[model samples]
Structure formats: structure tokens, C-alpha cells
Target: MCVAAVSTVQPVLAQTASPAASADKVDQLIKLLDDPEIRALLNKQTAAPAAEADTSMSATEFSALGHRIRDHLRKIGEAIPQVSSEFMRAGGTIADDINGHGPLGVFGLFLTMVLIGLGAEWLFHRIASRSRMHAALAQTDGARQNPLHSAGRHLFAVLAPLVAFSLASLGLFMAMTWPPLLDAIMLPLLLGVIACRFVIRIARLVLIGPRTGKDVAATAGLVPIDRASAVFWYKRIFWFACVFFAGWALVGVMVALSIEPGVRATVGYALGLGMLLVAIETVWNRPAAIARPHGRGAMEWALTFYLCLLWGLWVAGLVIILWLGIYALILPGLLKATTAMARNAFGGTPDVPGSGNPVVEVLVERGARAIIITLAVLWLAFLINKRSSMFTGEAMTDRIIQGVLAGAIILLVADILWQIAKAVINRTLEHAQVSTADSAHAARNGRLLTLLPILRTMLAIVIALIAVMMVLSGLGVQVAPLIAGAGIFGVAIGFGSQTLVKDVISGVFYMMDDAFRVGEYIQSGSYKGTVESFSIRSVKLRHHRGPVFTVPFGTLGAIENMSRDWVIDKFTISVGYDTDINKVRKMVKGVGAALLEDEELGPLIIETLKMKGVEQFGDYGIDLSFAMMTKPGYQTTIRRRAYMMIREAFTQNGVVFASPTVQVAGGDSSSAAAAASTVKTAMDLKKLAESGEGA
Candidate 1:
């Protein structure tokens, strides 16, 4: 019985420990179980009732996880009503405290506030209309003549309403003696009105600017238009949107004061539905109503897309309308602020180069905009979920927010690093340029500049790739598979393009070896030119005759750098055989000395010209060879100057230059003398004839 129990236990343990057992392990277990003595003992001990085994543990755990999620969602759904009831209770208490006698008393208070707000707006507008500053700002005349005039206008537009609201609030506090509770309830209404007006003012200031004919150019402005009609309609639509928002603010206050939270949300949803219908009606009546009369194609497309979706879809329509409200009424101010912040971060103002540092500036501005937009989107999502519960539930909402925040952080970090890298590169390039200007190291500095671009490009690509990976991971995507797939793809590419790989490798090695730098004249194979730039696998060479050559590193062999540290120039000049060799040598040396003393050539000349005496007796004259050393790229200029000076010096001293002459001397002296005498007699006879004609 004991042996049977042991055999049974060992098999059960082996099965549990290695369910997908290897062949060897399976054989070993079988052999143990099948031992003749053990098998006989087991059969005798009976089928001592096999113990029941439990399975399906993994399935059970999975079912439990699903149940937990469902229960959590149900709990969240159940608590939402309780939250709404609390808000309703709060609203009722506030109404009871404010209504002195009944709803009529509260109505009268609201009417009075509306009248005060309107009255102040009218009075302020009238006063501002009389000022020359406002007049100049409104007319769009002489705006470019004085930039401050336009700025003053934008400032007044933003500041005037704020000041008016402040005064109205003060008067409300001083003129009436309301209960503290009433003040608290009504104070929020006043604050909301102020905020609405402030938004309208800023939006107007940003979207509308001093007119440039039909166009507008501002620090924060929209694209320019070519027609006055388009501008006029754009302003009308913008103002209409602003007015709508202001009225909506008043309605929001009314809802807060009198309506329960559930009823308020229901009314908002119904209003959204009604607005969708109205939008459809407006577009149907006039297809071009949303489109600008003479706007760019992009603008027209944007407008068309907006209108089509605004009225075509159900849930998306409402959300788009809400986003449109934010864009027209809120985003302009944010954009203005972004521009100011970007400029200020670089200092109060940017220098020419810094301002032109579009990479860093654009990155900073866009990063800031992305952060603000992300926050805005999160807020909008929360609000939408609160009213509609359309976003699955709170768990999903939390996950979405978490993912967005994580992605934002990754992008911001990437943008910041990109900007820093660019700034460092720009600063380094500036220092190099200043240090190497008009010096022998200029070519080297140019090469360094060429490397900077490649470095910046690589850095940007790396940062962007990392940011993308982190964003994907934050969104719960599996990145390991993507990385593995990318590795395989890279290997495939390497195998397919062997020549490309060879070129890139050779180019990199060439750069590391410092064979030649940018801006240097070099010759390799049959191509010779000045180095214009470098690419990943080749160099751009600009020829002297205005052609650009792109030579791959793999094709280059035996490079000859013409513009290195120094260059030696050699040339020959022929003089008459009768010319004194010592005199000619002295004259050539004097010319070299004079060139060395020249202000421009003095620093370039490392060694003055030296005559190597007569090289050989040529057919016409004795050839004199001379050599000189000068700075690279300056040798040609120095040589030309030396030739000119030597010719001038020899000419002034009556030293004659060599001329081609032929004399027949192979025959006897008598034949040569007879030929010479014949030529002399013919010349004498011609002279005698001319003299006789003169007499």
C-alpha cells in the first residue's frame, strides 16, 4: 500500500510540475510508473480511489477581474445621481436666501444688474468714441507711420472694459445695501459678466487689427485677406460669436441661481440639439454663408468642413460647436499670450539671429501651445463627461487624462531638449565664425558648421523617435514588438543596399580622418572643385566654372588638396642670351622682396622668390626658373604679381625680352655671308629709291 501511494504521488507531482513535459522527462516518469513490481503493487492496492483534481484556475481569475470592473462602474454610476441631488439642494438653498419675498424679488434684482451692465457699456463706448486715439485706431490710417498707435489701440480695447467692469462692481457695492448672502450669490453673476466681456475684448483685439488695405498684419493676427468684403464678413461673424457667448454667460448665471443641476444639464443638452437644427437651416438657406467671399482655398475648405460636420453629425456636432466657441472666444487671447511669452523667454526682445532662430522659437511656442491646449482638452472632456456620461465612465476618463498628461510630458521634454541642442549649436557656430574670420582656420570652421547641421538633424530625429515611443507606451501600446520589428527592417535594408552602406561608412571614416574640410579646393579622381557642403554619403563640390558636383565617398580615390596650409609655385621666364644672368637674378629677387613688403601679400608670403639661374638654352632665349612659397589660395595672385613686376622692372632697365629668330648655318660660311649680303643690297636699293623720290 505504501509503495502504491508513493508511485501515485510521484506521477501526480510530475504531471503538475511539467504539463508540457519534454520527451526525456516523460519517458523517465513512464519508466518509473511502469516498473513491474510497482505496477503490480498499485493494481493490488486498488484503485484506491483517485483524488479529485481542480482545474480552470486561470479562467476563474479572469472572470473575477471582469466582475470587479463591472461592479466598480456600477458604483460610479450609482453615485452620480447623489452628486446631482447635492447640487440641486445647494441651488435651492441659494434661491431661498436671495428671494426676499418670492421669485419676483430675485427677478427684479437680475433686471437691475442687466440694466447697469448695459448702461455702463454704452457710456464707456460713447466716451471712447470721442478720443482721437480711438478714432485713429478705428480708421486704420497712419497706423504704419507710428507702430505705437496700433499698439495703443489694442491696449485700450482690452483695458477699457476691465476698467468699466471695475467701476460698476464698486458702485454695486456702495450704492445698495444688500444682505451678505444676496451679495455672495449676485457677486458671481457680476464676475461672470466681467469675464465674458474680457474674453470678447481680447478676442476682438487679436482677430481684428489695424487694416492694411484689405489685409491685416499684427503680432497675433489671422491670415491676410485680399478683398474688403471678406474682412467685413469675418469681423461680423466674429462679433456675432462674441455676442452669443456674452448672452450665454447671462443665461448660465440664471441657471445657476434658479435651476437644479439635473434640469440645468437637461436644458443645456436640449439647447445644443436646437442649435444643431438652426445651423442646418442656416447652411441650407445659404451655402456660401460660412465661406468667405474671396478667401484662400484653405479657408474655404475649413469653413465648408466646419459647417458640414456642425449640422451633419449628432454628438460630434455639439462638441464641435463647443470647440468652435472656445476657438473664437478664447484661443486668440491664448495665442497672443503665447507669442509674448516666447519673446519674453528669449529676453525682452530677440536679436537678429535669435529672432531668426525659428527652430528653437517655434519649438518653444508650439510646446507652450500644446500644453495649454492639452489642459483645455482635459477640462472640456471632464465637463462633457459630467453632463453626458458618454466617455464610458470615470475609470476611462482617468485613464484618458493620465495618458494625455504622460504624452504631453514626453513631447514637452523632447521639445525642450531639441531647443537646447539648437541653441548650443547656434552659439557654437557663431563663436567659430568670429574666431576664424579671415584666418587660415576658416576652412576648418566651415567644416565644423557643416557637421553641426548633421548633428542637429540626428538629434531631432532621435528626440522625435523617443517621444513617439513614450507616447505609444503611455497609451498602453506594446513597444517591444515595434522595436523588434524595426530591428528586422533595418537589417533587411542593410542587406538590400550594400552600396549605400558602403558609401555612408566611407564618408564617416573620411570625416573622422579629416582628409579635407569644407570650403577647401580638392581634387579626387577626375573631379576637382571647392567643397560646398557635405551630405550623408557624398560631398557637394562647386566648380570654378559654376557647376556643382556631387561625389560619393565610395568613388573617391587619391584626394589632392590644393588649398592646404601652404603652397609652392614655380614658373619660368625666358630672356635674351646676351642678358647678364646675375643682373636678371638680382632683378627677380628685388621683385620678390617688393611683393613681400606689400601690405596685402606680406603675411601670405612665407618665402620670397629665388632664381635658380638659367635652366636651359631654349630655341629663342635662356630659360630662367624661379620658385616662391605663399599661403594656400594666395599663390596664384602672388605669382601673377611677381610676373608683372619683373616684366616692368626689366623693361625699364633696357633688358630686352626673347624673340623668335631663325638663322641658316648648316652650309659653308661663304653661302651664309652671300645670303646676308643679298638681303642687305635689296634693303639699300629700296632706301636709295625712296631718297631720290624725296629729292
Candidate 2:
């Protein structure tokens, strides 16, 4: 009737709006009345019609559907009175309908069921204990090994008792065929038990995690808490909360079963107060599992942030106590299964130590999590669609769901990409470690390792930016303004941090040019040390005396690598003029040849030492210079060893070292004594020189 009325109005309005209602306008308006699409559009613009036509169902079919629904409802309405009279007759008693037995029979049945369930659980536990499956779970952490299998172990550990209880509850349900006991006691007990099991298992998992390793078992456990505190919280606060929440749910079931409103309200208030207490206790015993980042005033900030986050999580936990009754019981097992699948698909054992591909591992783990979370969200959305009336006719709900799904995909893709980049970089560094003794090869490896951190940072930034943009797009947000803002921000940062930019760019160029590799001893002005590592803006050089100098690439000038290529050392040796010059030269040459033949120093020496005879004629002696080419950083040791050998050879050959003498005129006994003293002084000097040389 409403659709007909609206259809009548649109044509009249369209005709009246035109000054002249031509034949064309009349025809168009008449066409609109017959067109279902036009009527549907009009219905959307106006109020919805009382009875909208179902194009799929004919008039006769729609009538049949309505009749069936009315008939079913009529049957229910008719049965309600009958059920009420029977309920009144029973008067909520625990009496059996068949024998008129009271509470004793019901209690006996309950006890029997409990024993049966307990017996079954015990038998199963024993079998599991002896099984190889249990041994596998005991040995491996199972995260990277077999996620599904590990998850199964956890699920079995947590859910086995619950499953047994459920079976027992089912038996009790069947045995208590008497309506009164079934309605009043059996139903409430069953709900309470199930709710309690879920709460307890989820709480235990959250507080201490699955029995994997002490550390891994605490992965999802309360952070920053000691074992004692964890035990205390579990026993004192969490257990209480679980029991309270379960009992509260039982009362809610009672309320649903027509319990007194006053009693229900009282129980609700009590539950609320108990939950508040639990939240307070949780805050008081905040876990110390997470560490604060190092910085000035960081601890305070971390504390504040974690406290707020913890409190919020607590509040959320309370709010979802009933909801968890749905998910907490099932999602964990499913998550484990999905994780196992991912591990099987993407995980592998590395062929060598440190060879495991982190990319594949991260991608597998994160991808599995994302997939599980996405599926879980979608599943939840589907449940909400079926159970909730809020989104039944709302078009915006669909848009929101789409937006959420889009954002998830964008984030997932970004995460996978980031993981891939990191894996590539890590794999490169791993391969680079196999470099040989060749300088170029080692330098290449060093440069590759040095570039990893910077590349990771760049990749992260790019991936994050893309992810943000894609997520915004998914959410129907305009990206143009954001892009413009980002550009402006970049310019501002570029200008404000010019020195940082310059340093980073200089470092980048230095890496590209392969100026100096890590571990090479290089000198830049006065500061010379071994290259320990490289950062985005600076290089760390460890000095010989254990000081680390962080030199910015921009500040470096004229780099001299002392550890590269060959080094030539030249030094002069002074000898007595009366000494055999050819013998001394032959001796020096022999020293170099002997050094080249030496097993320890042979590899370091590039060329034999050669003499430039009689480099200079000093007043005390004739100076001869010799030079030898050796590997970089080996020159000092080679020079020292060569000189020592030469001095020893000279001493054995009786070669005299040069010494200064003073002349004295001989005329009297005093003059003769002075000349004797001068001669004795020369002899003493020669002895002193020999002693110093030997020492």
C-alpha cells in the first residue's frame, strides 16, 4: 500500500514541476510507475514501504511464506501455556518423572557421569604420556619446527579436560530427562562448567602460556613479571576472576531462565565489582617482561605507555569475557593449525650455520598470523552478521568491512615485502662472509655488509610509506593532501638537518666508490685506525690503543690505507770506515735473503732487501741504506727482525762499529797521561756502543 502511494506521488510531482506537461513528460512519468527499479529508487529516497516486493518470490509464494511463519509462531504460542502448566506442576524440583525419585537419584547420576568422564580423561592422559607424539612435543619448541603439531599439543593439554566434561554434561543432559531438574539445575551447571573451563584455560595460557619452554611458554604471558609474581597473580587474582566471571555467566543464564530481576541485578553488580578488583590487581602487579628503551626519561614514558596499554587491555578482557567464551575456546587451536601449515609450506632448515633464510621465516610466521587474523576477523564478521541486527539493513556496514579488509591486505603485502628485503640483505651478508684472502674480494664483502643497515632502513621507510598510502586509500582517505604534506615535511627536514644529510650522502658515496673497506687500517689526517664498522653517517675506527674513533665521511680527507698492497721500508746503517765495505754489503744482502727464506716472514716479504751502498760518508762512519718491500702492516716487524740478524752477523764477523776520538799533544808526562786517557775514553766508548747494541 505504501509503495503504491509513493508511486502515485512521484509522477504527480514530476508533472506538476514542469510548466507544460507535454506528451513526452507524461509518457516518461507513466513509464516510471511501471518500472520496479524506479520504484525501488523512490523507496530509498523516501520512507521504506511496508511491504516491498520480492522479485524472486511470486505473490502466491510470498503469501505461502508468511502463512508458514504465522502457523509456526501460533504453534509456539499454543505450546507455551502447556509448558507453563507442566513447569508449575514440577515446581522446579529435582524429581525424576519415571519413578518420582528426588535429588538423590539426580546426585547419583551426576556422580556416575563425573567418574566416567574422569576415568576416560585419565586413560587418555596415560596413553598420551606414552605416545611418541608427547615425546616430540617435549623435545622441540615446535615454533619453527612444526607449528600445527605444537599447537595440537597445546590444544590437547588445555582442551582435553573440557572435552571430557562436555561428554559428561551431554550424558547428564540425556539422563536428566525430567524437565524440572534439566531446566533448573542441569542447564545452569552445564553452562557454568563450560564457561569456567574456557575462562580458566584462556587465563592460564595468557598468564603462563603453553608448556613449551619456560621462556617460550611465557611468550604471551604477562610481560615484565617474575615467576613468583606470575604464580601469585595466577593463583590470587586471575583464578578468582575466572571463577567469578564463570559464576556471573551462570547467573546470567539463570536470569534468562526467569530468575528474579532483583537477584540478577545484585549478581551483576557483584560481578562488576569483582572485575574492577581484578583490573586493579593486574595493574599493581604489572609485568616487567618488556624493557624500556635506553634514553633520558624513557623509563617514565615506557611505564606510562605500558600502564595505559595494560589497563586498556584489562578493560577489553573484562568486556570480552563472554565473547571469549566463543573465540578463546577455538581460535587458539585453529591458529596453531594454520601456523603449522605455514611452517610446512615456507620453512626450511638452513644447509649451513647462519644460513637459514630469515626472510622466508619471517614471511611465513607473519603471513600465517595475518592470514589467521584476517580469517578470524572475517569469521567474526560473519557471526556478527548472523547474530546481530545492527548491520542487517545498513549499507555503510559493508563499506566499513571492505575498508577493514583492504587495510589488512595492504599491511600484509607491506610486511611481506619488508621481510623479503631484509632476507635478501641478510642472505647477502651471509654469503659475503665466505670471501677469500684477496683484498678486492674481502673489500667487496665488507662493503656489502656495511650497506645492509642503510639498505634496511631505506627499505623500511619506503615500505612503510607505501603501506600507509595504500591503507589510506583502502579507508577512502584522500592521498593528495597527505602526499603534499609529506613533501613539505621532507623539504623542512632536509633544510634543518643539512649536516646530517651531507654526512649520510658522503658516506653513501664513499661506500659506492669503495674508498676503504671494513678492517683496513686507514689514515685520514692525524686520526688513523682499523675500520671497525660503518653507520649511515659515520665510520667507526678502532685505534691500536683500544680507542674507537667515529669519523664522519664528510670530515674525512686524503684517506691513506696502510693495510693495503705492499710497503717498502728504507733505513741507513752507519759502519766504521776501516770496515770491509763489500763484506758489509754482502752481509746486508745475505740478511735479506735469509729473511726471505724464513718460514715465518717469507709470506709477508714481497721483495728481498737491497743495499744502496755508501749512501753518505759521515765523520764517524760510512752510511749505507737498504730497502725491502713487504706486505702492508708487516714492514715494522720485518725491518726489526732484519736489523737484528744483520747486527748479529756483523758481530760474529768482527766488524767494528764507528766511534769518535779526541787527539792529544805529547810533550811531558802529563800530556802522555792525557793521551792515555783519550785512548782509554775511545776504548770505553767502543765498549759502551757494543754493550748498547747487544742490549
Please give each candidate's TM-score. 0.60, 0.54
What C-alpha lDDT, on a 0 to 100 scale, does residue 344 get in candidate 1? Answer: 40
Candidate 2 residue pairs that clash: 148-340, 223-287, 223-289, 224-287, 224-288, 224-289, 225-288
Model 1 CA deviation exceeding 4 Å by range: 1-188, 204-245, 257-360, 380-444, 488-502, 545-547, 554-558, 593-612, 616-620, 657-661, 665-695
- Give the best candidate by lDDT: 2
Q: Residue 76 in candidate 1 has what lDDT? A: 42
Candidate 2 per-residue lDDT, tens place, 1-695, comes to: 99999999999998889886589989999998889998888878665443454442345564664565466445544554454454444444434342565556655755666566667667766666666456656667645545445556666777876686677665656675555534455566555656666677765654555554445644444223456655665675555656575666557455535644444444454465565465445444544433324433554455445544543433332222234343554468556654554554445554555634567667766776677767766765665555443232345566566677668777877877887788778778777878586877876787777777678888898899889988887777889999999899999999999988999898878887778877778999978899888878999999999999999888886788887678889999888888999998888888888998999999889997888778899988988888999988889999999889988999999997777755566558788787878788888999999999999
Q: Give the C-alpha miss distance for residue 487 in model 2, angstroms.
A: 5.3
> lDDT for each of the candidates?
0.67, 0.68
lDDT string for model 1 (366-445, tens) is 66677776677666655565544333335656666567657876786777778778877877777666544365577668
TM-score for candidate 1, residues paired by index = 0.60
